[model samples]
Every structure is written in structure tokens, then in C-alpha cells.
Target chain A: MMEFINFYLIPGLVLGSIYALGAIGITLTFSILRFANFAHGETMLLGVYITYSLVQFSGVHPLIALPFGALLTVIVVLGIDRAFYKPFRNSPTIMVVIASFGMMLMVRSMVQFIWGVQLKGMTQGIQRPMIFFDSLRISPKHITIIGAAIVLMLAVHYLLSRTKIGKAMRAMSDSPELAKLTGIDTEKVVRMTWIVGGALATAAGVFLAIDTHIDTNMGFKMLLPMFAAAILGGIGRPFGAVAGGLVIGIVEEISSYPWIGVEPLLNPGYKAGVAFAIMIGMLLWRPSGLFKGKVF
Target chain B: MSNSELQTVLELDQIIGGYGDTQILHGVSMRVDPGEIVVIIGPNGAGKSTAMKAVFGLLNLSGGKVRLNGEDITNMPPDQVVHHGVCYVPQTSNIFPSLTVEENLEMGAFVRTDDFRPRLQELYDIFPPLAEKRRQAAGTLSGGQRQMVAMAKAMMLEPQILLLDEPTAGLSPKYRGEIFAIVKTVNATGTPILMVEQNAKQALKIANRGYVLVDGKNKFEGSGHDLLEDAEVAEMFLGGGAPP
Candidate 1:
């Protein structure tokens, strides 16, 4: 049982937490802005690179530099919104989506130009998991990932439920024209959406880099799982994304788990296919996801 | 309620504007003085709604101007127009469907820095149905209830002049009378109104003055009684043949 917990459940929980963070951003951007942001993966990768650069220059631990990188990512995301997305606010949603695809390529190339194609790491030494019981162990990095995710999620919930800007955001997301008629500055709402989404993306990136490794392709690889999580949670529901991400993460991780008693059920290489299957299955059963979230 | 000292709260001086590349209003002009109700009545497709949109700054005037208390507000973005003490309630989608009735009310006060609790209480007292459904989503409300929410939301700003584009567009006779009563009560509180309506008879009954717009130009302008009483105006607009 300890071995099972350590091997499958714990790792799945950590991976799930990262995807939860990313899916929250995707769900938020999708809910308010009404488009599938194809560049979301690239945004996360950009945050990781930003973290790597910040740690080198500021001489701080990766965790300490995480927020600084996230803050910088906010600036980058806001700039992207203003330059690429805002102009298409009145245009068809598909237009903005195509623009985001362009943004994906542009941001990917910029990351390559700055950080190069080499795989980057914040620490050189291998960190060992501290053993608890017989064959049961947990890593400090995983603890940090789990802890940070809970903190951010709570903060997000508070913001959405308690604050004035939060209510304004909900109002805008509900009916943009009515929000305008009520004199809520819509441009400001758009900016706030990006800020929230960008911050969450940064958190996901930092945690993922801490857990595994960082590269330009890490975000791209995580994209399928993150999107599956968002869709599974219901595309517009932030909390739903959380549940969706965890389920998808566990399912994906377990799909690759080597059988302890019998032959392997599936190849480990087919891990991504697990996310796809869940997404497709959910789409068929409940297109609105577990939350019945708004598609428009 | 118009005192001799009443100043025009809002005015459209021969405003000419429309949505992108399509001209709707052709030199439309009107005004709402302090504490008075001015109603615009016309046939469908006569630019009655367009005139309201032009005055509300939703349309960019290619020619002419819109003035609020003598401050030129031509072509201002609709969001900023509220700052000029003017609030507009569109004909459709006036309420945020997903927002609670109370949240909709709070949104109405988005521009105000002062506390809005007193104003909210006053509105709730006037529209008791809203107070009952304060926490309910506006989308789930009945048509009449939703209209009340919309009007109440717009009134939260305490606007000096309201541009209402058909407050009674779709409602039962009972709800229609209820809405008109509320409109009259709101206007009696020193907030003047400029409303466009399809129910000409009921609207002109309470209107201090009325304008008949035909093809986006002022065809007839008079007191509500005069417009309602005019044989020629009645024949042309009220679906009657020329008087003998």
C-alpha cells in the first residue's frame, strides 16, 4: 500500500496540482475572453525561463525567485493582450484564436532566442525523497508544489468571491454589453483577466520546473494535459478545472504505471493518450464538463 | 414638475450618426429639461431607437452634436457617458443574466465613489419584487421582474437624465402599466427622462412633451396632449385614415 501510494498516488497528486494551476488560467481566459488560447502552453514555458533567468541574476533560491518571475510574466502576458488580443476584441473569436496561435510561435521563438534550445535546470545536485515508512517517501519539491498550489487556489477563490474587481469580473464575464451599460470599464476587465491568468501560469511553470526539468518543449508537452483538465472541469468554471486537472493527472499517471502483479496494461509512452481519451469521453457525455460551465 | 428655472439636462442638436458605415439618424434633434419626461414616438424603422443611441454616445455623430448640461459629449464612448449624469437602458439584454439582482444593482453604481446602500434600499422599497429576489439570478426572473431589475440597475447611478429605449417593449398589459407607473415615480424624483416607446398612447399619457420622428427627422413636436389630440398626427401615426 505504501509503495502504491508513493509510486502512483503521490506523483499523480503533484502532477495534478501543476495541471490544476494551468487549467485555472485556461478556464479563466476562456470564460471571460471566450476563446481557446492556443498559446497558453508557451506562456507557462516563458514563466519557467523567466524564473531560471531571475535565479541566476538575483542569486536567490528558485522558490524565492518564483514570484518575481510570475510578476514579470504578468507584464509579458498583459503586453501580449494589449498588442495581439485587444485589437481583435470586437472581431470574431476565431480571429483572436488564430492570433494566439501566431503568438504561440512568436513567443516560442523568443524563448529559443533568449534561453536557446538547451534543457535548463536551477539545481545541479539530485534531491532525494525523505523516507517515512517502509518504501514510503516524499520529496520536498513535491511538498512545495502541493503547498504553493493550495495557497494560490485559496487566494484565487477569495479574489473571485469577495473583492469588488472580482464581482466586476463575474459581471463582465456574464454579459459584457450589460457590464458596459453599467459603466464597468471593459478594457480594465480584460486586463484583469490576463493578470490573473498570467499569474497562475507562472505558478504552474515554476512548480513544474522544480519537480522535473525545464525546456522550451515542457510547456508544449503539458499543453494537452492542461487543456484536458480545463475541458474536463468544464471550460468556464475555474474550480471545475481544479477537479478536472487532478483527475486527468491521476489518470494519465496511472496509465503509465508498470503493473506490479501482471503484464502492463498499456505502454508508458501512451500517457498523453490517456488525457485525450478522458477529454473525448467527457465531451461525449457532458460537453459542459462536470460543472455545466458556460461555453459562451 | 418642470420649474421655470428648469435647464435642459440633455440635448441632441440635429445629431447625425449610426452604426459603422450605415447612417440611421438624419439630423435628429431633441431635448429633456430638468424634471420633465420627453417621449419619442414613431413607426418602426423610423430611427427612434437610433436617435436615443446617438444621444447616449453609442453612435459616432458624423454631423451635429450631443450636449449634456451644455458640455459637448459627441461621439464619447458609451462607458464614459455615465459620468456625464446620463444613463442609458437599451431595449434588449439590459440586465446581466448571470449576475444576482443585487450584483446587477451594484454594477449600476460602478461609477459612484459614495456608498450606495441608501439608494439600493430606496429602489428595493419601490420595487418590492426586486428586494424579494435580491440574491436570485436576473436570468431566472420573469420578464416583468427582469425589466424592474434593469430599470432599477440604471437608476442606481441617480442619473440626471435617462435614455430609455422602450421600457415596455415586451410585457403583459399588467406589467406594462406597472413599468409606466415606476417610470413616472422615478421621473418625479427630479430625474428627467428621454424615452422611446412602442405603446404610444400609454407613453404620451405621462409624457410632458412628445416628438414624432419620421425617417429620422422631427415631423411633429408638441405637448403629449397636443400630439395625442392632433387629428392629422393621429391619422398619420395612430393607424387612421385622414380625418374628414
Candidate 2:
């Protein structure tokens, strides 16, 4: 039990926090923009690389360098949106979706060109876990990641519930035509979507980097699970995305736990299949997801 | 009264427009004077709603002008038109279904920079039922209640004029009567209303003046009582009977 708690559960939660953060952006973009943004994973990768460079240059913690990375990422995303997405605003949703897929490849290539395809570590060395009650081991970085994620989630909640622009964002997601009739500026709302989505993606990338080494393919690798999290939570439901992310992350880790004897129940090698299975099951049984989000 | 006070608040002059080369409004013209309830009643595809859309700049006009307070606002987008003190509640999908009723109203005042709490309270007073369901999602409400939410949302901006497209489209007669009464109460508050209504008789009963549009042209324009009394209008459009 101690080993399961320490090695599987704790790691699952840290990974879940990162997935939750990334899934927020995916869900927001999917719901508000009316397209599944394929470039979202690359957006996360771009932020990670930017934060990696900042940490290398300034010798600051990734968290400390995160805001700068987020700001830069937002700028780049806004530029990309204007160039690629804006023209397809009135076109069929598939057009923007294909554009994003193309953008994914383009951004990945750009990252490879600039940063090179090599793994880079955000921190120098892994620190030992702080043992509690002689058996419970919780790493300091895990605490920081979970704590920061909670703070950010709370902030997102406040923004969506309390602020004017945030309410407008919800309004747009609910009904774009009504939002326009109500005098909500569509472009402004889109810009705010990118800002919030970009910042959260940056935070997600930074958190993941702190947990594991940063690689060019890191974001792409996590993309499927994050998407599974978003769909499981509900397409446009942010809080649902958080729950979905935690569930997916925990399930992926626990699927390999030696629940039956000690042979590793499902073999850790097949962990990614768990997300795929959940996603397929969800699409088949509850396409609207757990929160009754928009279908399709 | 001063000349400016008598000036038309909203006017559509020879407005000609439609969707994708289909000209729905062929030289449609109308106006709403201050504090008046102007009803535009016509059969299906008669350009009643299209005229309203043209006024709100939801569609482009090939010829003619939309004037708010005598300022030409032709082809202005819907968002910009709201800033010009015109709020339009579309016929369907008018409320943010997933948002709470209060949030819907808050989004209604999205363009307003000043404090809108007092205005919100004022709207709540007018629409008492909405106040009760302020926290409930608008979509979960009954058809009548959702219509109320839609109208109340448009009222949040305290606009110079309110444009309602079929406010009582799918409500029961009881709710329809309630909505008509609510329209009168809103007009009593001095905001001119220009609405397109399917319930022509009831609408004209509440309207100060009304227009009878046929095939995108104004067939008859008179005081609501006069139009109701007109034998030709009664036979063709008002279900043919003695004036009730």
C-alpha cells in the first residue's frame, strides 16, 4: 500500500495536475472556437521550450519564469490566430480544424529548428521526497505543482464566474449568436480565449517539465491523454476537464499497479491504451460527456 | 414638444436587403416615434423580421438607410449597433441557454462600462418571474420563462430602443397574454419598442401604431385601432371577422 501510494498515486496526481491545466485550454478552444485545435499540443510545447530557455539564461525556477513564457506564448498564439484562424472564422469548422493540424506540424518543425531535438532538464537534479509518518513520501516539487495548480484553478473559477470578460466568454460558449445579439464583441472574446488558453497551456508545460525532462516530443506525446481528459470532462466544461484529467491520470498509473499478485496488473507499457479505451467508451456511450457538454 | 423630441427614434428608409441575393425587404420603410410601441405584422416571408434585421444591421442593405436619432447607421454590424443604443432580441436562440438568468442579463450589458447594478435591479422589478429564477440556467426554464429571460436580457442595456423578434413565438396563450402585458409595462417605462409579432391582433391591441406589410411592402399604416377597424385588413390578415 505504501509503495502504491508513494510511487503510483503521488505521481498520478502530479501528472493529473498538468493534464488538467492543458485540458482547460483544449476544452475552451474547442467549445468557443467551434473547432478541435490540433495545434494545442504544440502550443504547450512552445511554452515549455520558452520556459526552458528562460531557466537556462536566468537560472530561475521554471515557475518563476512561467509568466514570461506565458506572455510570450500568448503573443505568438494571437499572431497565429490572426494569420490562420481568423480567415476561417466564417468558414466551415473543418477548415479551421485542418488549419490547426497543419499548424501543429509547422510549429513542431519550428521548435525542432530552433531548440533542436534533444531532451533538456528544467532542474539540475532530482530531490529526495520528504517522508511523512515514516511511510508517506511526498516530493517537494509535487507539492509545488499541486499547490500552484489549485491556485490557478481557483483563479480560473473566479475569472469565469466573477469577471465581465469571463462571463462573456461563457456566454459565447453557450450561444455565439445570442452573444452577438447581446452586444458581446466576438473578436474580443476570441482574443481573451487565446490569452486564457495560452497562459494555462504554458503553466501545464512548465509543471510537466518540472516533473520530467523536456523533450521536443513531450507535448505531442501527452496530447492524446489531454484530449481524452477534455472529452471525458465535457467539451466546454472547464471544471469537468479538471475532474477528467485527474481521473485519467490516476487510472493510467493504477492500471499498471500490481493489484493481482505482483506481475504488474496490465503492464506499464500498455498505459496509453487506457486513455484510448476511455475516450472510445465515452464517445460510444456518452458523447456529451459527464457534464452534458455540447455534442460534436 | 420640441422638434427633436418629436423626431423618430428609429427609422428604416427604403431599406432593401436579404440573404445571399434573395431580396426579402423590397423598399421597406418604417419608423418608431418616441415612447411608441410600433408593431410590424405580416404573413410568413413577408419581410417583417427581415426589416427588423436590416434595422439592426444583421443584414446588408443594397439600397436605403437605417437611422437612429436621425444618424445614418447603414450596414453597421450588430455589436456596433448596440453601442448606438439599439438592442435586438432575435426570435430564437436569444438567451445564453447554459448561463444563469442573471448572467444572461450581465452579458446583455457587456458593452456598458458604467455600473449596471441599478439597471439590473430595475429589470428584475419589471420581470418578477425572472428575478425568482435569477440563478437558474436559462435553458432549463420553460418556453415562456425563457422568452422572458431573452427580453429581460435585451433590456439590461437600457437602450434607446428595443427590437424584439417574435418574443412570444412558442408560448401558450396564458404566457402570451402575460408577455403582451409585460410589453405594455416596458413601454410605459418610456423605451420605444419595435417588435415583429405573429400574434397580430394582440400585438396591435397593445401597439400605439402598426404597419400591415405584404410581400415586403407596407400595405397599410395607421393607428392600431384604425387598422383593426379596417375591413380590408380584417379580411386579408386579421382572420376575417367583426372587430373585437
Candidate 3:
């Protein structure tokens, strides 16, 4: 049982960390911009591709490429804002959601066109699993992904609590017009939000690529889980996203095991089905998710 | 308040504005002169707040012009209006609730490139309680203190004319007096104030000029004392009282 737990549950947790990171970005963007960005998954994919290209061409270490990838994602998302989102900002929320869906399609096709439909394995050679006790084990790749996530989450917490920009973001989330009246440059705050959100999502994408092979479809697959985690945690609660991700990870993994002899009777293809079942159950039980983040 | 010394500071001439198809302010005209206090008092739906919104460019002015010191400012965005030496404090959530008192003030001077220490100290001297609670979150402050922060923030630009939308709403009588007293001090510094207030008597008492609005139009306009003494205004507007 312990060995099985080490092999699956631990890896699920590592994957959950990535999902949490992505979900935090999603929730932040949703709160500030007031829309679910379906295109966010592409931001993560772009991060992996950019880092992969950097490692291939620039001879930069994958570890060093993390920040570079995040920065690139920030620039791209900011560019998207300049090109698209900011223009239709005053339009209805549904319109913005449609636009983001359009953005998602555009970004996905662009990635496919450029990178081709191929899986590219990471060449950084940080994949050796480190044994922890008898049954628990961790790898350098997992350590990097988990460590980076902790650092970024802490940094985000401090930034939101201690910095002027963070306060402005929260204020805007609470009441945008009031924030403007108080002299917060709403544009600057929005830009800062995009930067932080894009950076985190990009980092998660690169970390996931480190754990698994890189492909354009990778982010697409994780998109549902990330969204589920974010919604389960609450729409705008940052800390809730992290916790929601872990809970989702554990639930998905534990449920995929043999359910009273059913797993022995059925093939392992039921794992993804079980994950979605848990997600649906969560949605039915709590519509606002656990934290019930901001309404406006 | 004679017209000779009262140089025109703000003017909204035949202004029409609203949110989308619903017209809120219908040809509302008003003015404020430098170093003067102009109060607009009326019933709940009298468009007093809408008039303030028109001046601050919060609403689309469907018709007419808004001018500040002779420059046409009709339909200018709020940020630009702030740059034109006019600051507007909204009625509710006027201050950034999540920010510290000092940070809220800092945002007030966001457009300023110069060092704002003198202005900060000036506001500190103006509101001593705020000075003590500089590090406190604006949300954590009492309603009156939040109103103070909002007013102090607008004053950071040292605006030539300030527009306040119901500064005394939802405050205790004691806090209302404190807010009105602060308004007097703010005006004493030579910034003309045009306020739409629910407390008609109290507002008119402090006003050099008063406009009693009824059904989106000015019903009466005169010196504060004149309005206070008018039988119609006394009964209908003030609900019968000497000026507070």
C-alpha cells in the first residue's frame, strides 16, 4: 500500500502543485478582469515552448529558463491585453468570455502551426527520483516544481498583503470605480495583475513540461483540472486555489483505485472519468466552491 | 456672496446626461465660483448626484457643456478631470478600502510627479485622527474616518474646486458635524466646494450659495441665508428650521 502510495499519490501531489499554480493565475485573472480566461491554458503552453526553445538554442539551464519563460509569458499576455482584451473591456462579460475562447483557439492553432504536433522530452537531465524513507520518494524535478511553487505563492501572498500594487488590485476587485476615485491608476493595476498572473501560469507550464514531455496538447489536457480546482477553491480566493488543487489531486488519485472490485473488473481508463466525477460532485455540492470569493 | 468677487470656477450649462437610454439629468445647469461653497439639496431622485457625475465625467453628458475656469471640460474622463484641478469624492467607498490611509492618500496624488511630502503633511495637519491612523487600512476605519480619508485624498491635488457627493450620509450627528467642519476647513483653504448633500439644512447653513433642486431642475437658487429665510424653501426644502 505504501509503495503504491509513493508511486501514484506522491506524483499526483506533484501534479496537483502544478494545477494549483495554474489555478491561482486563473482565479486572479478572473477576479481582476471579471472573466474566465480559457486562453490561460495557452499561456502555460507558450511558457513551456519558450523555455524549450531557449534551452535548445540559447544553451540556458532549464532552471534559469523558468524566470525567462515566465517573463516571456507576461510580455505575451500583456501584448494580448494591448491588442485585444483592453479594447472590449467595457463590453458585457459574456462577450469577453467569447473573446477569450477565440483567443484560446488562436493561441492553440498558433502553437500547433509553429511547434508541430509532436512530443518533445525535456533534456535537462533532472529526472532521478530521490528516495524519502522506505516508501515515500521525490525527484529533483518534483522538488524544483514544488519549491518554485512555494516560493512564488509566498511571494504572491506578501506582494498582495504588503505592496501598494497588491492593495490596488484587491481594491479594484472590490470596487473598480471606487478604486479609480481613490486615484489608483486602474490601468497600471490591471497591467500588474496580468504580469503576475501570466508569470505564475507560465512557471506552472514549464514545471509540468519538466515532469512530462512537452506538447501543445499538454496544457489543453490540464485546463479542465485547473479550472475545476480554481472553481472549487472559490473564484477569487488565492490561497483557496492552492488548497483546492491538492484536494482535487488527492481525490482524483484515490478514486481511480479499485472501487470495491470494480477496478479489477474494469480497465484503468476510468481514472479520468473518476476525476471528472469528483469535479461534478464538488460543483453540485458547492456552487461557489469552498472559499466563496468576491462577488463583484 | 456677490457675483463681482465670485469668479466662476465650475460651470455646467444645460447639461443632459444619463446611463444608457435612461436620462438622469435633464438640462441641469449649475455653477460654482472660486472660494465659495455651493450646495445642491433635493429629494432622493432629484438628480443631484447625477449632476455631480456629469461634472466628474462619470456619466455621459448627452447635451450641454461643462467648464472649469473657462475651459470647456464637458465629457472629459475622470483622470483628466483630476489633472484639470478638480477632484470628486463619490458618496460610498470613496477611499480604496484595502489600502492603508497613507497609501490611499498617495494614490490621490498619483498624477503628481513632484514630491508630495508637503501635501501629505498639509492633509495630516488637516485631519489629526487620520494622522494617528496613517497605517490603518481605510476599510478598518470608522465610516466618518473613511469619509475623511476620501476627502483628504481628493485634497492631495489641491484642487481649485472639489465636488463631493453626500459626504455626511450614514454618519452619526456628531460625525456629521465633524465632516461638515472638515468641509469648512477644506473650503477655508481657498478650494471652492460644490456638494450634493442629503442633510439640506446643514449643507445650506455652510453654503455661500445654494441651489434647491426639484425633479432634475433647479427649483430655487439664492444666498444660503436667503434660501433659509424663504418660506417655501423653509417648509418644503428645509422642512422648517433656521439654518443649522
Best by TM-score: 2
Residue-level lDDT tens digits of model 3 in B1-244 = 4453236889888988788998888788888887899999988898999999888888898799998888899999887888888899988778877568998887788777798889999999999999999999788999999999999999999898899999999999999999999999999998999999989888888999889888878789998878888888888877775445
Summarize candidate 1's per-residue lDDT along B76-175 as a digit string, tens digits: 8887888877899999999988779998899899989999999999999989999999999899999889988988999999997888899998899999
- TM-score of chain B taken alone, every candidate: 0.94, 0.96, 0.95
Give the docking tier of candidate 1: medium
- Model 3 stretches with alpha carbons more than 4 Å out: A1-5, A124-126, A132-136, A254-292, B4-6, B21-26, B121-125, B128-137, B240-244
Query: Per-residue alpha-carbon lDDT of model 2 for A216-258, expressed as tens digits?
Result: 8887888899999999999999998999899999999999898
Which window of 10 residues has the lowest lDDT sum in candidate 2 chain B?
B1-10
If both were scored by lDDT, which would come out higher, candidate 2 or candidate 3?
Answer: 2
What lDDT tens digits, residue by residue, belong to model 2 across residues B6-98?
488998889888999898888988889999999999788899999998988889899998899988899998888999999998888988988
lDDT of 3 by residue, A1-296 (tens): 77557766777788788889999888888888889889889888888888888888888777797798788878998999999999988999889899999998899889899888888975645556788776567777778878888998999999887776886777777677876665568899889988988888888888888787898888787788888888888877788889888777766666556557645333556655555765687677776778876543
Ranking by lDDT: 2, 1, 3
Looking at model 3, give its docking quality level: acceptable
Q: Decide which is better by TM-score, 1 or 3.
A: 1
Report the TM-score for the A-chain of model 2: 0.99
Please state how well chain A of candidate 1 matches the true chain A, as a TM-score.
0.96
The DockQ of predicted model 3 stands at 0.42
Clashing pairs in 3: none
